[model samples]
Target: MEALNEELERAGAWVFGAGLEPASSATVIRASGSVSMTDGPYAETKEQMGGFWIIDVPDLDTALDWAGKAGAACEQPVELRPMQRA
Candidate 1:
């Protein structure tokens, strides 16, 4: 993972990355007619996002390459999604 990060940094595509705490430690807040708070993930599912990386690559192909490396390093499936531009 460190090697991948280094490679990304070298390529100037590394924006930021981080690992999150367990889903059990999460707190969900909602605001509708009234504000409410709930414990745990917003939804229960077989898979959860353990961590993520934000990179600035030229295109989907480049991002996919990095995601593949990350998946191999972690021995887990990685999800890739483009960020919405402001």
Candidate 2:
């Protein structure tokens, strides 16, 4: 993963990246007329996001290339989505 980050940095595609704590450690907050708090993820599911990376690449092809590298390095499937343009 360090190698992947270094490669991304060299290509100027690295923006930000991080790993998250386990879902059991999550806190959920809700407000609908009032406020409420809950423990764990917002939705009960078999899968959860373990971590993510934000890359600034020129096109989807470039993004896919990075995603492929990331998935191989982590030995896990990676999900890629574009950030909304400002």
Candidate 3:
């Protein structure tokens, strides 16, 4: 983990962001015609997002490459999503 963080820092790709709380600590909020709040995670599933890393890479392939590295380093799946552009 330390090595990965150092590598990302050296590559100028790490975008520091807040780490999410555990699923048990999450509060799900929803709104349409009216606002409603729910305790716990948005869904009752074993799979939950613990945290995220925002890495600025050249393209999707590059992002995937980084994701692969992350997966190997952490022994966990790394999901890649493109940023929405205006």
Best by TM-score: 2
- Residue pairs whose backbone atoms clash in candidate 3: none
Write candidate 2's Cα lDDT for 1-86 as tens digits: 99999999999999999988888899899999999999888686778888999999999999999999999988889999999999
Tens-place lDDT digits, model 3, residues 1-86: 67887899899988873357778998888898999998988675778876678888889888888889888877878778888877
lDDT of 2 at 78: 97
C-alpha lDDT score of every prediction, in listed order: 0.91, 0.92, 0.80
Clashes of each: 0, 0, 0
Point out where model 3 deviates above 4 Å.
Answer: 44-46
Q: In model 2, how large is the Cα lDDT of residue 70?
A: 98
Candidate 1 structure quality by residue, lDDT tens digits, 1-86? 89888998999999999889898998899999999999888785779889999999999998999999999988899999998999
Q: Rank the candidate models, highest TM-score first.
A: 2, 1, 3
Superposed Cα deviation of residue 22, candidate 1 (Å): 0.9
Say which candidate scores most in lDDT: 2
Off by over 4 Å in 1: none
Consecutive 10-residue window with the lowest summed lDDT within model 3 = 14-23
